[model samples]
Target: MQDGLLYKLAALDSEFEQIHRLNYETFVEEIPQHGENPERRLVDKFHGENTYIVCLDGEELAGMLAVRDKRPFSLDQKLPGLDSYLPRSRSLCELRLLCVKKERRYRKVLLGLFTKLAAYCEEKKYDLAIISANVAQGKLYRNLGFIPFGPEVGSDGARYQPMYLTPESYYGMKERTKLLSRMDGEASVSQKHMNLLPGPVDVSADTERAMAGTPVSHRTEEFNEDLARVKQILSSITGAKHTAVLMGSGTLANDAVAAQLSLTEGNGLILSNGEFGERLIDHARRWGLSFCTIEKQWGGRFSREETEKALDKNPGASWLWAVHSETSTGVLNDAGMLGEICADRGIDLCLDCISSLGTVPLDLARVYMATGVSGKGLRSYPGLSFVFYNHEIASRPDKLPRYLDLGLYAESAGTPFTLSSNLLSALKASISNFSAEERYAELRKRSDWLREKLSDAGYDIVAEKGQESPAVITIPLPERLVSRVLGMKLERSGYYINWRSVYLLERNCVQIALMGECREDSLSPLIGLLRDEMKSRHRA
Candidate 1:
């Protein structure tokens, strides 16, 4: 058996036939059955119409099952005993023909399959699951928390138990299955099919414990002290003396910086290399700030000479805006170099470091103003952004708008304003995990490890080594596979990595960020899977 098995709804035609063959092998040949011609059964009425899932052990078939509305089975005259137990008015889903090969039985393939079925029932708002439990497998169903409520009956000369499971009981079983799946190394394998994939890194026990307390009032003095402490810690980590947390997203921080810093007599010089950089320009335009752009390709980086020339051309510019890390293309711009140039030219440097601050080394001493999010590199929940600036910018007595006023945040010491105490607690807990130097070292080590693993797997890293940010590693994909298809494949392998945008599809790039608790040991198996997938595609 393969180390991994992914389950997905089987499509029509060839894939459907493959699932039927696997079911025949498991249910008819290996398991005890009374149905005739079970070995060569061809599903006709219910084969292509209903929802069915196929389990794959790498590129090979493993098992399958079908689910359909329970009404048809409930109306059957031949199965009156089973029909009586099923609710007539309430909607129910029936599980049918669940099968697994003999070799894969010990791996709990049946349990995982049933767990998925239960989750599906709950998601589809089904009231109950009505099934005719096989006589030989009655004990297994009972162990799975299925209760036999109706009278026993004999079918096809074989005894069977009528069992049903409620939605609540089904979810209770799902929770237990999730716990067992984690222990059995199947949680990671099953995560590929989920929509919002959970990261491999588990939150620290200390952080979890810290977040267990009750929420506090953001307007209170105690909350003010807590907010100040968090800001001081963030400042120490990023080498910024003045950091103010806002009540909105990172975009608000970016807009705040654009609003305040574009006060110069001339147009702002906006650098466009990726999505975030382009967004800065958009913010500037919306605010009606005079601006000019020094545009580059998505993955392209600006050399010191090119930057100097751009600055020289826009000599009247008072502010230069850029993104430290472009999340869209997984590109990290040279903030330090850009900061120095802006300072030299008497231009205030405003940076969008939303995705870079926690994972990448940053110094606010060089940067005039910057924006960061509580999520992303900070590893906290979303809904807050921080704008860090020098005292000179904060002290500007321009009578700024109440919401965009940096002075209000500074006066309150990042509290007394409208803020979410729960998110603030989460941020404080997330930041307390490591010291500044420790976080920098960890980010660099993890990024380098992932890059080395992908490189050893015969894949090309999108960003050049040494110049890339420690937050994410982007890979240039093979020509044959599109980003969407590759994303679906990797998702099935239980690793949820980001793909480059549609605009960068021509570049054939895929990105993996080091945000989760993925270990070095797991990388080998993941690489092996990628290799096998690519090889199979070539053969096809």
Candidate 2:
């Protein structure tokens, strides 16, 4: 309903009306599972316990399925020793009454409902799910990662087979969309907006497959080994001495860096040329770290002279902080030069390398501390952030907040608190598969080509030549054109440009990111689309 499709919990009177009709059509009319009734409605016996997930296509119920965790499942009654027949599990659920309109053509109704089912199971911590699937739809069910178990039940055309779904089994089927596309002819990948944002970039199938695997205890040796391996790879790539993985975002990682900076004996010099740089000043302020800031216009390049003058003015500065890539303006500061300056001045250097880490070649060996995330150019899912440090850090249980305490995380081998093995596994797969040489070249070449295309199309690029980062390209809207208006238009057309962030809105800007697996040819159409938007604006 919202943008032609909506997946939600079935609650409304109207939604229930459609659900009952669809259930009757599926169970009675189609499957011959129920006796015909005058009302033509066949609500399930477990309707009271059922949590129905429905897909709505402009107020029309496209498809639906109900989940109920209460025991004495429909399958339990049909197949007498259900528990004995199945694998051991802590908690199980029953999924029933699945249906999509048989008379109408639906785009992704059933796919959307099944995705919701998977998410709901995760939220409820259901280890396994049981379904008495229609025998005729066995291939479709198996394609959805359901395993058939026990003997068939019911008479003739109404036969049903007991099936179960587990995370491992689901992942096995969902291992790659390539398999699905090959088997089903068309890719069953549900509706996806073209991802051109800076973070939460389109992840690879390997990363998805890794994330789909069942999680292990964070405290287990198996989990710690994965943790150590990821840390080692990160350190090796960035030339950082150590890396501490935390279950948070880039902002949280920066806060951790600020906590470390707070320990410095003298003042720190923070430079602000864009949004992320300004955030560093805020982080330092909140941490009560004594610091001086050198402010410049957004997208302005910080020269060696400007930084040297700032350090000279604050001779006693113990550390320096700045963003390696000012994501808001798409300006990439020279991390190498900054690292050298700090080395010569005997000051610790820290960088917010959140957006720059994977897009650019980094040598953080000289950097005292820096921050990165699991998403961004890594092409992994978000939620995991890293604090890379060049020195051994000890636990500081007394001074900093427990979660932001980098020392605590470092001393404990990056898992002082619970960590998500799902995110960790995905990150490992992405990093392991990443080709630094190839990816860097691709981003740089693509960034240059896109900037040229946009510029030739009569649009102003925010970052001037020699200042732009390969990761994101920020474009300011013209005086008459509203950012939100243009962004909405692009989104409805399936291109998700970054424009809704508070800072971007304040600046009246939108962005195109080259953070993930983007191609030059893939961007030509987008450039033409932008050119069309501008042409229409001019015509109007």
Candidate 3:
């Protein structure tokens, strides 16, 4: 079961039941380690604490293993002098219940187990691993870099050897045709922790290396060339005639848009269907602009007819503001529809497309102005923001703050103050040759797959179906389970999902945003944790 088998962390009740059955099959019927029971299920005493990574052949369990970092391992009881036998490790984890089905014959099953084990160790930062290897397969264990560290333990008929594995010894294995090294080569070494944060997300190794050298002066030609390149890539992605790379958050970009809007005379209509939409309203209000609003529930979406009606009521509304992707609620308002509506009416359109820019293909060549950030969707370091506009602006040196003045940024060649060359270099690396079309399809594919899996596993997604953003999925936790508690629990298990923030806490919601460097191997394992959580709540 090479490609047919699935190797991932054990998270669901069904998987756990199968695991227990396999435990009975391996430990009781095969090894005689435990007495047989009528239930035909042998639960490991450490089931409460052990983190199980399994190999599955469709619904059936092909093989399984578990890791527990807690002290006083089973080996400690079996061998009195276990501590002296083990080498010093910065952090240690005990691997147990490594049983492969007889049909698997140890090779493929063990290979898959070790592959999953590698990812698990990478996540938990476990440098050294210890296992009680069955003496019958001692040669295979030794081949995989397990060194016998203590005397044999267990009954003569069912003996075991205490062994340890370290990265150095594992790599030093002369035989290198194993699955662990082959399947996950560079990914395992670099991206040990899977980051699921909405923003300040993980950057690629190349992106990090782009920022490694000494910072160049912003005034220098080299730094200015990088500035021009990033701006060109952003313009290509959004189709904006001009883009200003500002040094701040997405809010700063929006603030600059507000300053631009302050010059317009007529009333504008702000759209609000989520938290970010409300923030847009705040941006308008703080700028002292007179604006009407079309407000909806946080996760609700705006239809074209409703938007048209709002514009109709606010007769002579000169501009319209809306958020393309609502990060807080995982709702994506239709920017195209809104843009079309505004275009026909001659209403200038301003958008907060921060979370949508790199995740989806956006056409904004005809739009008035929009905001984006380097970190969230672009997968770069966070210190930079961009404001994209199609129209030219008059410099408002007297009316607007220097940073908020879009005209100043454009007129001064997108550099009014000193900017971090490191940030710009990383940003350029991330966005250069921007492939928004391909990224859009991939992001949607993964989001659809993940959403279906989560839905089938008894999780309640916050955004209504067909209205949710493919880049982020907001899940409302059950009334009994606090998002903070559940989110932190997953974090301890090596998944850093989004929760604990004020907005998420207020709504009892957690988000899984597939922003940067997401892959099938990393995303699929997350479902087990989610399913496990659902099963636990039901049991309670």
Candidate 4:
């Protein structure tokens, strides 16, 4: 929902009643398409089979349209042999009863209805949509990608031009609508707050320009070179011999790691102290990997003794997995110590460095298979994830899924399937100038300044001084104040901070992630805004 209006299928009894009344208002009184009803409500003849998509403004129906799949549709009555007259489609549907309230016409009621209808059709696997649109609104239909199919048809004084919308037209219109909506949204966001969310960090101007450049085919030599460069840079950063880039989020990379672990014979131990570590449990379960978890309190650091205890419990454990930087709690675990423990036990160690990859100094050379993403510490657009492994993945099991199979990805030279050239190029540009030591130092400086200032302001820090990551800072909200409420207030005041996750919201915690493109000068004002907001909330 947006602009104080909701668009969805009219499923409830009250909603269906509103649809009937709206039908009467539009067809009976306004358009004269139906006979006058004493009840002031007109139900369509195919109401039993029709699925109405309605837009509501604060419980009041503002606009609606009906979709039906039954034979002898309204268009069939006007234009005989409708299928013969239009493009051949296996799964066809008819749309009718399009109407909007007079006062709400200025709003995007029609567009909302169209969007809902499009989603509904897509869900139902509809290939084509036919509409007998009012002749006066022909231009509107055309603009919506509905092509006039046959001769204008209908009874006198209420003639309609039959039109059909194919999948191609529907998708094209949807993209255009999305582009325009995004343009408007970006303008509004530029004048308001800049987002500082962890995953979708603000992209730099050069990366944006790289993303905007003309796309190349994934199989072409140019795209292959770009993909190779991204993998090489990631390999260099992590100090790994090989890296495989996947077209998904960091979760996908972790899932691939889980899948790879499933191929191994013995049990594994997963360390958990935060949300990301917990998610790895789910991934392991989905992959059907036999593993035991060494659980710790959120924001709590893991010691070598704990790792040794978990290994001692699972005597046959073959690998150890843990998150380098627990983004949820701002806990930066000792991966080096954990690696040493695994090495002593003769067990391979896998790390989830999605949040720590470029934020801190990391050495993945000794790591078996570690996950990293293009966004966050990498300072690039999301949609690309990588798994860096020291071993030859081609020697792993061959029965794994095509997308999740590290061997398949490595064998295909990192372009296992259709990779987005734009995303690869943007990531390449981001990492081309990346300096691990310099970025880590800069982030450490910023984190130190922010932590000192925040602690001085009497905030409860989630992570202790020496144990915190260089790029993430978490603070607990005062008693009786919801983190989400304060987060929204900050957002409205031209600032955006991460909060509202179940883990954070339940504990009244808010996070300030220093991942994306940002500077020291920008931090002072942001810190000021946060300080003022907390003070105001304290007063309240």
Candidate 5:
């Protein structure tokens, strides 16, 4: 089983029996808090009124706690004057039945449970939490910010201490715990996904922490400084003169490029070889730009002859657009050739470098415009797209949508209205952690290793040999195998391989993206898993 554990609200009927059984195991058999029943389950008196918080170890009950605010709480019955025992509060609730399985006791089960419970109570507007803690774990309660109240109260040789934890106390104790953990050289255990997708990659601890920092207003000078740094980093990485950060997806960035093109007097040529390239055509059409298309089969490379022929055919075309790395087909188009052609012909070159921005080596000095996102190869979260241009695109069509206008974003220092500080901080952390050139080298090495391994395993690779992008590998499954089924199986095992999209399904392929937060050591294990999965499917 995966080591990751989940803390969530316990579902009634579905989880009641397990909750009762666990309660019996802890309160009756283990702690002797209740009399043993032949039913093998111990139902709490306030079960109906309780909101159960459960810690799950892959659908197995690992630990549980129940919270209730019904009048005359169990603690109230035990202590007549509960208000005097606890501090004054506007809203009060009692915590009960905190239990952890023996196997999971040493893990962070209690910590996770308490974290969820604290959030739940706070959301319900509970100012204070009262609990009758078993005297055996008194130290744990005290460590969790629960203050001992009144005297001990119990019956039948069972003893308990009444304790209360206010929101302030809980938060204060959380800070103390973090500080102590850090002092003790203990790091927070991450339960993040092993992200192998093209976007929203696996975030490093530093990036996560940066995002968790206090959020600031986007209009502040502090945020603008960070935003300026981010744009500078992008420019440095891509060799673009000016980069604009917009709070949207890559499609929006591409649309912004199209919007800029709309301001130009000359028509452009759009090259389509895959989904994203076709989407650029859509963007151009939507922008109502007079553009001609040079369409090619998916996964096919654009030859200089045909490209030049198309450009010659449309002498009025001032711009040539293509996806540098077609994400859907895993084909890395010949940008060098295309850029040279555009330069020789005095035509502007635009690229959809969303997937290649950091995963592949790029020098955008020759290109006039490009689109990228904070996610994908940049190793940051979604919701931020960047438009890298060599020259100023300001004052281009005042009729364009404000949000999609690159000039407006540049004028406002990348925050036209409101942007997310968390996203910006995370992007800064991601880019700062590794240089773009270093990331590109790593991706190339990993992709080569994976391709060699997959080839040895007899998988049919999509992009052929030299035409493939180092960032993504598309593998077509055999006739007997189902691409999406295997993809789902791998997903259940916490390994995400892109599959089942229209392009992939039509091609009977699944894609493995080698971008963003992927480690070299993880490549072999992933290959081994893929081999095993394929073998199993073949055997069946």
Candidate 6:
């Protein structure tokens, strides 16, 4: 047991009896007694197969609940009617024997245990949950959206109410309550404090109007003209002569790059420190590309020596890939240094700048190729991806398929092969309002403010001060709080944060990026909430 709580599966030995004793104490001694010999009931066959999640507060057994196959429990003759509403299929689960020690009843301990049970049911894909709610607790189940299947009846003269809860109903109630509570909490905070959380950064009115314009035929000359305009603007922003606008996501852009590079003769080097980098390697391997990697753990950054050594060892490598801003770790690698090394070695450098682009300083002059999306730092809708490559790679005519060929895009179609004129107009409008330099400066300012606020609140950042990405700020969560709990708590408090898990071999941490309309003002209330949550955890 740690932190005054014991969380574990119930054992069949003395611990199980202890839980039974607590159940008797709560139901028989404390509450109204419905069954005879409640103090010492014999262990039944049902108890043998059921799994129980037992929680103890210090030496005191605080709670115990039994979960068993729903089919048997729902269909059993001993229980009140449920077959009328529920199907006999094995798609359901039953939650039984929910008992919390008297002291822990209203303290959220039972709620926490029930929340875990709900999560477990959802994960296991159980379609429904059935419970024989007692008369006194019938309103509790009703409030939770559990409907009674049949008339209330007594089990051996012990008044019980038969209830049924579908997975959809349960989750719907859960999510609705969460959203309502979140909105209420946000409203409780001052508007000045509320605005601290990131965006609904309203898109420019002109840009929205442009996007609302009539759609153009993809094959029409007018469409090509709009496409050309978008291509020029995209290239100007990234300092690349070659840029492509695809109908798919940024993943497609990475796929295209991987497909194009894998056609080469030699091995490739993948620099992986976060989820996206590892995703790139997965894409390469899926496409059967020969590759080696220099990996850093999650929330960890690679040193210059480590990168140089990987390049030195893989002398045959003709292509190198790394993420400019690893959204997972919120760390920005030294792209310029890596680019120079790859260029000098006659290797093509590909960068995943999906979360970086307009938020950071990028020079297409240094890197050979890069992939970005319209959504994340570009602040547009997510349908399009821009692929930028240097003149050398853009001029290559070798083995790339027509669709994946950057050379073909450069020489002929420019950005769009089959374009959405409205998206093109939106891209132009988003870029026209702000220069690349202005975007970079604004991002830097916002990220700095965020870092300061988080640091003031006593959070440890994943990246070093000066080495962090201007677009993202990653913070290490306290060991006592799981990422899921942290995310749910923040969501309830009207803030959404991303958590990292891909490089689990390294560390578990949370990341907060300033890409959206997030501001420093939102941080104050969030810090207060964090402090409260920390106190609650410590108390638990």
* Winner on lDDT (2 vs 6): 2
Which candidate number has the best TM-score? 3
For residues 1-540, write the lDDT of model 4, one tens digit per residue: 657776666644566788899889888888877799689999889999987888887668999989899888887777777778887788989998999988889536777677667667877899999998899999999988999978998777788989899989977876878743553343344233456677788888899999999999999999988888877888888899999889999999998998888888899999899999999999999888898998889879988777788788899999989999999989899999998898888999999999999999989999998998988899889999989998887735556877888888878854868889999999998989998888888889988988888877677788898999978888887875678887875664445789967888878899989897666755665666566666656787
Locate the minimum summed-lDDT window of 10 residues in model 1.
Answer: 192-201
Per-residue lDDT of 85-143 in model 1, one digit per residue for the tens? 66553777766677777677764566656655655665678887766677788988876
Instruction: Rank the models by lDDT, top first.
Output: 3, 2, 4, 5, 1, 6
Give the alpha carbon lDDT tens digit for every residue of 94-207 in model 6: 777788876677535554455556645665677777777888788877867687876665544356677777766776766766643343233233211122211223355677
Instruction: Please list the residue runs of candidate 6 whose C-alpha ends up more than 4 Å from where it truly belongs after superposition.
Output: 1-202, 392-402, 414-416, 499-508
Q: After superposition, how far is residue 418 of candidate 6 from its true place, in Å?
A: 2.7
RMSD per candidate (Å) reads: 6.3, 13.3, 4.9, 13.0, 10.0, 10.8
| Highest-lDDT candidate | 3
Q: How many clashes in each structure?
A: 2, 0, 0, 0, 0, 3
> What is the lDDT, from 0 to 100, of the residue 239 in candidate 6?
81
Q: Name the candidate, 2 or 3, with the larger TM-score value.
A: 3
Better structure of 1 and 2 per lDDT? 2
Q: What is the lDDT of candidate 3?
A: 0.85
lDDT of each: 0.69, 0.84, 0.85, 0.83, 0.82, 0.69
Candidate 2: where is the Cα deviation over 4 Å? 1-192
So what's the TM-score on candidate 2?
Answer: 0.67
Worst 10 residues of 5 by lDDT: 183-192
TM-score of 3: 0.77
Ten contiguous residues with the weakest lDDT in model 3: 183-192
Could you estimate the TM-score for every candidate?
A: 0.74, 0.67, 0.77, 0.65, 0.65, 0.61
Rank candidates by TM-score, best first.
3, 1, 2, 5, 4, 6
